[model samples]
Target chain A: MSDQQQYLIIASHLREAIQSGELQPGDKLPSEARLSQQFMSSRGTVRHALEKLRAEGLISSHQGRRSQVLLPALTQDFDSVVSFSQRCQEAGKTPGERIHSREMIDAGPRLAVQLQCSSSASVLALVRVRLMDNTPTMVERIYFPEEIASHLSDYQSSSGSMYQHLVERGVEISHAHSTVTATAADADEAQALGVAPNSPLFVVNQCVYTADGQPVWCSEQHYLPELASFSINNVKERPSPSFFTPGRA
Target chain B: MSDQQQYLIIASHLREAIQSGELQPGDKLPSEARLSQQFMSSRGTVRHALEKLRAEGLISSHQGRRSQVLLPALTQDFDSVVSFSQRCQEAGKTPGERIHSREMIDAGPRLAVQLQCSSSASVLALVRVRLMDNTPTMVERIYFPEEIASHLSDYQSSSGSMYQHLVERGVEISHAHSTVTATAADADEAQALGVAPNSPLFVVNQCVYTADGQPVWCSEQHYLPELASFSINNVKERPSPSFFTPGRA
Candidate 1:
């Protein structure tokens, strides 16, 4: 094998060991001489493999001490709009959804302004708990305008992707505006998410618009922090001002 | 005044009241008749002003019920990269930094890989407590390579903007990659941030890179969630995938 490919292979092997818990957080990695001997590679190749892992923030190394493992954090892309199910599938985890409630109600003042409709307009509200590997991860509460609500009477079976459902129905999905905040879960949220009351939760409020800038749906998702996080890449071309700001559509 | 100008002025008045804590969270707003009488405006104008506040996520309203105020959250834009001091100044808050430690050390395994240097290379590490209005909000630990470290010995006086300082030194910062996760505060982190042991904290790990793709610095910032949150706008054009996947330069 090429010298470059050998380091990649060694890195992947060590990465799998870390992921499988064979190498745990704070556990010291084997010495470079030992790793080189075990992998039948040169010291330089072993160091290159270890450097790859370090660059990924998986292990910490000191000058004279062996590298130590770090707890792996689950990361979610904050720049793209993807369904929970798609995200789970990509991570090789089973995704499930349990419908909690689905009902049609008059658009109250808050919903009216968000939907840009009259206060009396009828809207459909769907609340469901999103699960990863049968563990409750997030509770999503979504509201759809009457036009889209008319098509999904049996939403319980169709709880997977509302964005896809809307797109199939000729509603062109465009961009989304999302706000992420941390909050302590209230009793209702705590029970729904299967966490202690007042546990830290990552709350994401998002509004999805259509191609013509018409608001299609607004959702509030409460996520258990242990199971989820977000990542972003800030390019100099479009500098981000602050970590949290009211984004204009 | 024009009708549009009247509603905006009333909305700003209520917004200022909320900001100043004259109206507390969960406190009911005055009746429309009372507000119209107080402001000497028409009932329609009062309702329009309330709607504006509602759209801003400041207050909640229901049919035939008084609106309730909401707790204001400090939001940071995740897309734009700005200094904490700059962000505070933009929000009309004073920013301060307390240096905890600034020392030169050998590049350990983690630092070596992150800085793309040998373990024998010397790097400068700086730890500081970030404050907003004299209240501790975050603890930042940053590491710089020898090129930058050689020039910055008195970081305490130069703590205003590390990016700006680097820019003034002829370092062209291109972009940064950041990962946001929730973690329980350890003893040192807890004490520095003035939070209880094991309190939930927002941890952001970021690596800034130069224009030519050279890694400049790596930072780990632990934020008090009560004082900070993150915001992002996801457009359809750039679809981000696998947040933890090793990002290519």
Candidate 2:
């Protein structure tokens, strides 16, 4: 296995042991050298695995003492937008969607700028509520261009998972770009999310693209902070100097 | 220039032309072939540049019509954490900071759990406000381990940017992990940010590490979403069948 996968696997095994109560709080973990011997990994690899556990607040080694259990595990967080679907299945929870409204509307100046279509073009707009185990968690405002909207023979079933329908129609979703910001819930959003009016929420705006580079759909989703968020790891580039031509953004 | 940088430069040139009124709304852009010849770029490269401009609503091509200027361009977005400092300098805005409070406190169970230190250990905690154009934009709550905290001979000037101080102390800051979530401003946060209680804000939690993999400092920064946010681009992984041992997180 690759070093990355090796460390993560060791961390996962230790995490499961702690979660299963095989290793209680204040219990000492095996020595790093012993773990390296058992897993046939380098000493650095074992330390990395232990550090991963420590980063999650699971284990700690301090003041020349051996590593010991500190706290229980947390719900694993997801960074991808597909996490809403992937994490639910991982946790064995049923993921669902409820369509609140769908209508054909004129592509007004604002949305026309988004879909790159004329203002007179007809667009399919929808308001959908995503649920986890029947509890509403997110409210989404979605828009599709006229070319895609006109091909919806069974819009209801397809709306729940447009990816499946699109795949069957020979469309492959390749990538997406997303922006996340904070917002206060409006009355409509609060009602749909079952939160108090003006509650704080995360608003994620994304544009999905097909493999052929066509913009397929755009969505603005509002999520309760307690239920959803994202994380990222960043590396600082030590730019000795950057003198490339064009100096592009 | 590389293909990626080439397209961005062309798009930037167009953006500036539109912003300076050299290109007006409904003005026709030169043909892709013509642009390719002008920039000495491949046709595909020129097309990518125009497509980028179209994505930002600066220009658009309609059915069987030449590409024309559409809506003006939007503000360029940033995906990196250092964007706050870099963007302000680019916009010629003065970025400022104010230290509100600093104190040495016992690492309570809550924070000790985060720092991996004993509850009785001393930790340095500080609160500071970051400003842009003399307007309060964010409030930061930061903590440091005892070892690093004790090395602070001149904590005042250094707190503005811990990076410079750490570098001077033979420490090289490397990478960081961050989480983004939305929250309602508490009373203390509201007063610091000059906003109403319950105002929606973006809370960024970050753990910074040194080059040798030691955790250096942790900070929880609260930002007014209207002023600051982040974006990301993601790709859907097509997982082929896998039977490898040790499936890890």
Q: What TM-score fits each model? A: 0.61, 0.65
Error of 2 at B9 (Å): 18
Which candidate leads the pack in TM-score? 2
List ranges where model 1 is wrong by over 4 Å: A1-80, A188-195, A237-249, B1-82, B105-107, B119-121, B187-196, B237-249
RMSD of each: 18.0, 11.6
Clashes of each: 14, 0
TM-score of chain B of 2: 0.61
Error of 1 at B159 (Å): 5.6
User: Tens digit of lDDT per residue, candidate 2, span A65-183?
Assistant: 57776544432321224335445555566667888889999989978877778899899999988777777878889899988776665655622566566666776665555667789
If candidate 1 were superposed on the true structure by all CA atoms, what would the RMSD be? 18.0
lDDT of 2 at A33: 78
Cα-based lDDT at residue B120, candidate 2: 94
**DockQ-derived CAPRI band for the predicted complex in model 1:** incorrect
Q: Scoring only the second chain, what is candidate 1's TM-score?
A: 0.63
lDDT of 2 at A218: 84
Inter-residue clash pairs, candidate 2: none
